[model samples]
Target chain A: MARKRGLFETFQERIGAVLPSALQEAQTRVDDRLAKIPTRLNEYGYDAFGLHPESSRRSLATSTLFYRHYFRTETFGIEKVPSGRVLLIANHAGQLPFDGMMLGVSMLLEAEPPRLVRGMGEYFIPQLPFLSWAAERGGNLVGTPENCVALLEADECVMVFPEGARGMNKTWDHRYELQRFGLGFMRLALQTETPIVPIGIVGSEEQQPGLMNLEGLAKRLGLPSLPVTATFPLLGPLGLLPLPVRYRIHFGEPLHFEGSGSEEDDVVQRKVNEVRAAIDGLLQEGREQRAGVFR
Target chain B: MEKVLITGIGSGPGRLLTERLRTRFEVLGVDRTPWEDHPAEVAVHVLDLRKKGFEDLLRTERPSHVVHMGFIRHFKGDPNRRHEINVRGTKQLLDHCHRYEVTNLVVMSSSYVYGAFPENPFYLDEDQPLSASRSYPEIRDLVEVDTMATGFLWRHPEIRTTVLRPVSVLGPNSRSMMAEYLRQERAPTVLGFDPMMQFLHEQDLTDAIAMTLEQDLAGVYNVVGAGQVPLHTAIEETGGVAWPIPEPLFRPGVRMLFGAGMAPWPPGAIDYLKYPVTLAGDALAQAIGFKALFGLEETFRSLRGRG
Candidate 1:
């Protein structure tokens, strides 16, 4: 009375038995965690500064696979981020912004109270198809002083790459080297009286190492910079996929300075230098502590 | 009792305002076309603002308050006629308002005068420049009408002239461009560009106008609904499917449809779908003591079961 089952049938039977329970377990965990969050937190569940709750939730779930499993991101000092209105000044690297995604995920998943960090995107990134809407829905606002001021006034945590596009398009030789930080973030923090939390991200520079930048072509195409990565252009869209580089994010102590947002240039620059130095030191520490790129 | 002369009573807001103000003031409604049904107490006059009858109506009615809702938007008529009816007509009306010594004047302008530029701030206050004419010439009449009103505001401070620039008035009875766009089976939207839009429900707008007349608030005020929604989301919420076309193809596509008499909007309206022209309602809320009764969801919900 023993009928031998086919290999495919056995596999299908095994998946049928396991998949629902696995999915149910995941759904329960999400529901329980979401239930614990206060209703006030859910106030921003729909749309806040172009953040679409449904789109953000879907994208976050997909990005979580990369953040938790692929990158194996280990976040440190996330608790240093204050409860209300903060400017997260982070080092920008990786021709693509996987580091920014990880930082955002860390804040949402690892922090005591999950916070959605609004990333200030490059000016041109919002011009791309599908990407722009998704970015806005995922809480990425176009980097403008007006937007920053409004977000801060709303008591939102905004992440800024003070290095701007220069850091993102840096060649492999200059990897891990901090570019000149713009004075905008400091001025915004001063204006809003929001604390600045310096963030240092490691292993992002190795994710997609840039060999050269086609500046002229990028300009013609209305892009900021078109970096020729090792795999990109040669491998097509598949080349755009980032290598699974383990990420270590360090959140430093909140830096507060006294002055109206309209401080003198030298004063702003001095404060900017202080933030850059803090980030540089953290980056150094992160690099030294890391055993390997994929660790 | 103060006699109030309201123009463009054929329009939705005008009709609603006329009905509401009739209870408080002796409402004299004037339009190029006669209203099919108007309240028995309200006196209705069929006269063009551009014609001498408008001035005669003003002189005869001798209303203490004058509300100019007669501006002919671009979509309804040819450009030259629209200019004659809107710009020249507005100039004539303003001349009469000054000549007749009307104590209060409320001119209905649109937020479109702010211009939908990529660099526009999220909430443009009343002081923002009228930049719509910079790109699209069709709306030049609206900008000019607003300019003339503002100029009249300061020149005739004794009149207490209030220019109300309301954002995209939408409701069941409204025929505004935004409303018309939403009424379409498939609203055309610029692909990859979903600008945030604010809508002032027809009732709320009438309420604001009533408040303006009652309070005699004299300044350029931006009246907007409670919240904003992106164009795509707005279409979706209104149960209309969006036909997303690439940016480069949008103008040409609109031009083709318009040429074929199939599209409701002209090609010049492409910029609006690409960038936001959202207005701040702070002045209306704080100064005029009026808040929008309808939220964004309610505004969109009102569009349900309507074409």
Candidate 2:
């Protein structure tokens, strides 16, 4: 320029010229999208089922960065999830449960009429300290039959992973393999007369690849499992960071069954097998369509 | 005119109940100390319920209705004194009420008697066991007083006893532990738990007591406000910050503060903050035809230096 500005000053001037408009444009887009959501439908109220509006809004904003920018998550067949009182049954894997967060994001951002999907967490979630409170505030509940029935009765969309912890702790050699499903969710679907939507989440299995598990150490530390990954423990806390893998979420058509929610093992198992087959079918289809693991 | 004897007049709800009932009935108040700002229409008597002189006052007043609002809550005094006043004093009062042939007796119990446990159902009805004493010895007196009152109710059908187990009472003038905790600049919370809580306004509870006295309801009822909120959310709405600490460290921290006389609550009180003990008020509504004028939000708002 006229005064022969320094290199730092030149860079500062360039950033100052564009940063405000860029930030304002991003803010406006988020506000417009949020304004479209029916925020008043806190049918359970602000903290109902432990879903705090402030906490949830903040958590979702942070997760959105990972969902859109880091993972570049793409959702397909989102319209298949019916409105009101439906159960979302999905495959669970990855040492970390980012899959649940991704599915929640897809429902909020991509669904026709954005719905808050309440996820049922594992049994050990409530035992943890800060994680338990944060999880609840983010609209996750302890997995229990009573909680599921109450949520459905309140006309909420609930997401569940019937595979439980077994699926989430799979080794690197067994990636993408679906675990045996628990039958409780089937009984819940029948009891509430709610339709079920089978979801197949690809890429989450490869997010945090587990090589081995240290059971004794994990038990002593009060953890479900101590996973030894390529980057974990070896790299300390930094190793816990998930590798950026493109996520593809497939939501299948809703399936409805008519029966009394019974505790009989055989009766419930038959229904569980049907839902399991649907998810496995979707998982296979998603794999065939993928260009590559990281694509 | 019918006469009513209201005990624990020094407490907020007791005084409020006296003010509301004085216009309709001749009211007499009995407490360990005198109420400095009570209405002139009500006659106040200074005496201890655990001591020997209350029986004579009962004989002299011969009140048609007796309101037992004098139970010593844990935060106000020493544990031993609270136990003696709550358990033994209640027993003595019941014996005197039976002997005097009082037509109606209303006792104030707390929802805390149900105890805050992990496995509790969403809404605790009147039939739920008094489990608070199991974990916290501080609330043992409350369970005993409740047991004695219910047992006395069956023994003397003519008394027509109604035990009102209300949830946390909060207002501009409330002195309950919950109200005091909410009024703090920063409310301490358990690191891992955010239990749903219900609050009833002081006026609503007084109104319920008035109804119980005016009517002939004769069973235990759970009195609660319209709705509930998570403990942290309530604190946030009231413009207070939540100071969360780990569960293991919380007890020892409270103990240190208590030792220095800086903490307002006992260490045993941490259990309530960790789990929920919310009560369903449907039974109270059905029994007394009661509906809360202030919802849960309004109740919390009232605690922020406004009525």
Candidate 3:
């Protein structure tokens, strides 16, 4: 088994041979961070959620390229994230989930005590071929309340995009504008007694400028939305590639709310609103601090 | 010695359970099928559970404890016959247990009754609905039997009833659907969706049953194995190659093959392949200190050569 190489690992090794010094440094850094993170693995070296350190290494190595060079992501207040169970509530954007990747990488590379952030993906995620398995191997699970509660109970860090698809499908005109937040996260926070860390990410919103959203076509094709960007529908799949944009991630201090999680709907929504406001505040700060989108 | 009447003695775990329980209790076996082999100490009764003869045996023998495992599990045979035998048979068995004044009843249910859904929690508790019939309609009989057993638990408080919903059992002596899937050199799986799967060794299942019989706890409990593994990883560990078929082509293709008698499971079973149905064994663990001795590797390894 040690002699074998997975397709991803082999591709990474080929990349490593070309880059040599830089890629090797990135690989060691990723390995070092992963070694410090504790997880309950079965005899076969797979966590209950199908996360294997070997698979995560390959995934992190690929993401490190985007984090370090492609995006040149700068993280702030990563130390604000408290140890033990935490719910990192962030404003989601970027037609794709580059924002999620950056936040996850921030938690891994920038945090004092590096923590593996388990991302909650949309329901449609599991239906997509290859992505579903790869997502699980990378420690991102289908965003169900039960999955979140389970992770929190186990004292693991969980990331949730309360804005969901509404924020991801926002047009370029609506960038940095927080969408209606889902109250489920607040209820979960109350239920699990886990703290919520508001995260604000800048530059992901400008990755793909959405001119118009083709709701009908998206519904027909069974997609979240069909955005008519400057390049998309014109450049096809290649157009989906996000333009190089500097990413600034801001992690805020932990906010604690006390409740049995069975509170009234209005109460939960109010608490959710508080979280949304905090994220909005952080997004403003991130935007003001960044010199420019590319700088 | 306390007498224990075990139904479905002809099945894979049936014989094993009898062998395990014989030392502590005087074991009596009953099954519609014949228990052909010679066992001088244990007596075998070949009778349909729904028939009058089973009631006669129960009344005469008067076993203090009853372990029911006689459900028809396969998708083969007439659907009506399967339902009648599984559902009606269980109702009649419960009635006989009540009539014969049996002190204890252990209904061997399965975690598959909860159904495999993308929306299912990682570890489903006993309270979760038996929604398997909605997706896998062929197993409605199993679901009905399980539901009936739960109802019987509360209605008949005098008879201490325990329902054991064990995860997919696999081993050399196992005849479960999961075991059959792993036995194939090339197993068909839903493309793109690799759900987490749990497996219990047949010996561990028997051990759970033995433990349940020894304890006085009465309620519905999920009997899980050591831990869980991805479906594809489980296939590889068990020495089987996964043949991933796209969902669009997989469902209908499986149905066609099943109709032609070339497939192990019907199309309904595809949902299970596509989604996870993991269960929490904490209830049983805390109740009787139940734990599976076989790890995921050893459990999968058991199915290697037998295939």
Best by DockQ: 3
DockQ for every model comes to 0.21, 0.20, 0.52
Off by over 4 Å in 3: A1-22
Q: Model-by-model lDDT, in order?
A: 0.82, 0.81, 0.88
C-alpha positional error of residue A106 in candidate 2 after TM-score superposition, expressed in Å: 0.6
Best by TM-score: 3
Model 1 Cα RMSD, 1 decimal: 6.0
Task: Report residue B239 deviation for candidate 3 (angstroms).
Answer: 2.5
Cα misplacement distance, residue B7 of candidate 3 (Å): 1.1
Task: For residues B71-164, write the lDDT of model 2, one tens digit per residue.
Answer: 7774556778889888999999998888988999998998989987665545678998998888777789989999899998888887789998
In candidate 3, the residue pairs with backbone N, CA or C atoms under 3 Å apart (3 or more residues apart, or in different chains) clash, namely: none
lDDT of 1 by residue, A1-295 (tens): 0011143246434654665554344344434443443323222244536666554554565466668768999998999999989999999999888888889878777887878788887766655656766777677887888889988998888999988779988999999999999999889899889999999999898999899999999999877899999999889999999999999999999999888979789999999999999999999999999999998
Rank by lDDT (best first): 3, 1, 2
Q: Write the per-residue lDDT of candidate 2 for residues A83-104, one digit (tens) a residue.
A: 8899999999888889999898
In model 1, what lDDT does residue B247 have? Answer: 76
lDDT of 1 by residue, B145-219 (tens): 999999999999999899999999889888888898889888877777777788888999999999998998899
